[model samples]
Target: MKRTLFAAIAMAAIAATSNAVLADTPSHRDAVAFVDQAKIGQNLPVIALSIAKQTVTFTTIASKLGNAGAVKAVSDEINALLPLYQPKWNENIAQAYEKSFTEEELSSLASEGRSSKYASKVLAQQGVIGKQMESTSKPILTDLVTQALRTVMSKTP
Candidate 1:
């Protein structure tokens, strides 16, 4: 039993170390840098707000509540939560970049921004990339709106 437990602990440690190493791989780091260089996270709040506003459930709830104050409250809550959401969104975009481009391409993009030789390839794959981003972001957006609604409702009469 002691030997089995020791082996289990050793396996867990190796898994944890491998995850840390993978996260700092050249491609992953370059992807993150490229995301920053492209200013991808700068408009996240705006996009989140847009997504929230477009959500039918959110609008229906606000209309049923029949209070501009509630709408504003939800908006305010979303704004407050955006800072926490930004890093997650940036990481998702970075993962997308890592999947779509090689380490060298990511490094060049990070250094050169949109003027990199890979820019045209990126543009050509815009639809695919957009779908990938949207697929990942949909759940996060849903959660954001749900959280905002909950906050507003909890404060409501």
Candidate 2:
């Protein structure tokens, strides 16, 4: 009885957390717009295909694992998984774009991205912006990781 009650409570907690996460997720349409503004779709297909190709190798050991005379197992598995992976890749890209940009930024970006001059200017400054972030964040992240590792190590011995 106690175990069953605990399991029910745990499930309720997980469901509540899931609902909260879903509620916080940005609009999918806004995410799609953000992806378009960022030109993420232009290279998404090529990147997804490349990643899928590599992923095929990971699950191709069915023959070696003795899965009952599996000659075309690898090929069959790859074919089956490709369709599943493509949509996930697109969804992940959309989610990333949504999480990274606010609705106002996405709206402005959609309009500005259509302008060649604006895009060119933004593209030119992109590298500088990345460098600025790297400079500002590297030290902070390094310190955080170092401290975390030291804590773990100290706790161990």
Best by TM-score: 1
lDDT score of residue 142 within candidate 2: 33
Best by lDDT: 1
Instruction: List the candidates' TM-scores in order.
Output: 0.71, 0.35
**Candidate 1, 85-111: lDDT as tens digits:** 667667766776676688899889988
lDDT of candidate 1 at residue 81, scale 0 to 100: 86
lDDT by residue (tens digit), candidate 2, 11-99: 22222222222324435465555545565433322322233334332234322443332223333443444454434333444444344
Model 2, residue 125: C-alpha shift (Å): 11
> What is the lDDT, from 0 to 100, of the residue 139 in candidate 1?
58
Question: Which consecutive 10 residues in model 1 have the weakest lDDT in total?
Answer: 7-16
Off by over 4 Å in 1: 1-21, 55-57, 64-71
